[model samples]
Target: MINAESQLFATNTSTLPLILIDFDQTITLQDTIGPLGKFGVNFTQNTKPWSYFVDSYLQEYKEHRKHFFDLPKGDFKAFVAQLDSYRSIERASQERLSQYKVFQGVTRQALTDQANLLRAEYLQPGVIDVLQEYKDQIRIISLNWSKDWILGFLKELELSKDCIFSNDLEFDESGKCTGNIIPTILTTGDKQVAIDTFRQQFKTIYIGDSLGDIEALIKADLGIIIGNDRSLLDSLADFGQETEQDIKKPSSLYRVDTWDQIRSLLQQHRSI
Candidate 1:
């Protein structure tokens, strides 16, 4: 548990920096999409197999990337425009799941069970410790499909669930999934909007890892990209070309391979 005395630097606790964390590959060792798809398939009846949806989504993503890569690479505006175009692909995939009723019969208890299966195997080492230490200042902002799954995962970690903000699986009064997402967050732009809502209340440190995280990362006071993934940096290099500001500068945006580095960074800010 965090020592309450250590948080006494600020008279108004709301002035402290808010740690907005991303789920999926940022917190877990692997992306949850595939596992989540398999879970949905196991519990619900669908016209096609799980791999069919997976293949279809990948095909569309690959085609989009093929065209995206062919576009002039050095233009930041063009790069952002291209990145935002991914929302259509995301929407199409969601629509396919809804049309097929892929998760229609899943129960809340089943989601909790799936989270338990993932909790021990998927979480990145040291993530739980960092989260527990700064629990009061942390808020999970994710593009994940199920808020309940994230909540369940946090419950397993013995962490608070009050600060999660993400898209959710719709459920009926009978407590079964309705095979539709509430869609509060679907694009990088949507994430930016979520981050912006907190700007007036606290200094923001947004930590994420993906193309979808670009805007939120840039918008925050400090942005930490997890892992050594080059795709995010390579994409930022496009924006780097047109701006006077260097996107890779450590002061504004930093990258790390582990949660220990994040803890170190947060320690430096404990005095603020």
Candidate 2:
């Protein structure tokens, strides 16, 4: 159902739509972090399911939830800066996670294998078709995995190089991931900065799930939301009751349950 805030923004026929695609639930069926965690667990502890690790990570960050949404925008940005610095140091030495051995050593082939490993099972099927159809206009801007991981995964799909904006992984002299993520210091708000860069140049169409994606969703000329029921519930539960109002979203945004709808919509809107 393409529910829009108003009539869909009129896009130019001569220009291709500049698309910003989210990675987690939007492109993939679920959060990439879950698979990453699974990779970590099996790589480290030889465990299956990955829940133990995820539960622990969430618990560790539970205290921060109080300020996660309520913190002033600038204050939250500053907080991420400090946290990013600290996480880089901590993850580098996280022997268990590094033992996953997927990215610890930074050979190009190893990265591709790891990317394919996850992509084979998890990547959204229809999303890739749309991307290939509009490859030139699409730019993946995700807070999901390392730049190496996203690019490598896309390469496996046989999708040629395209513009991507995301976090990076650092490697040692040996080409091993240092486990320290060099932070873009990105937050949900930073996404606005990204969309703002291109909104004027093209009819920006943003697609995402979760409240972390809410800002870009609302700010775009056309925001296509994936899984409205799930997105709102998860966002509200994750942020708190106050987020109920925030998740109501603007009319400019629309909803779709599957990626095929997105492809169909793009095909419908593109000029002959």
Q: lDDT winner among the candidates?
A: 1
User: What is the TM-score of candidate 1?
Assistant: 0.85
Error of 2 at 146 (Å): 1.3
Clashing pairs in 2: 5-251, 5-252, 106-175
| Highest TM-score against the true fold, candidate | 1
- Give the poorly placed runs of model 1, Cα more than 4 Å off: 1-12, 65-75, 156-162, 241-250
Q: In model 1, what are the clashing residue pairs, if there are any? A: none
lDDT of each: 0.76, 0.58
**What is the C-alpha lDDT profile of model 1 across 1-272, one tens digit per residue?**
12232233235465578888999999898998788878887777566899898888889998888765566756655666777788878888888888888889788788877887788898889888888888777778887888778876777445444477777889999999988877766777777776776775568898888877887877788778887666777776656722112233337677777888888778766634
lDDT of 2 at 96: 33
Report the C-alpha lDDT of model 2 over 108-196, residue by residue, as the tens digit.
45656677777767777766766777765667777654666677667634533236666666678877766555554255655666667
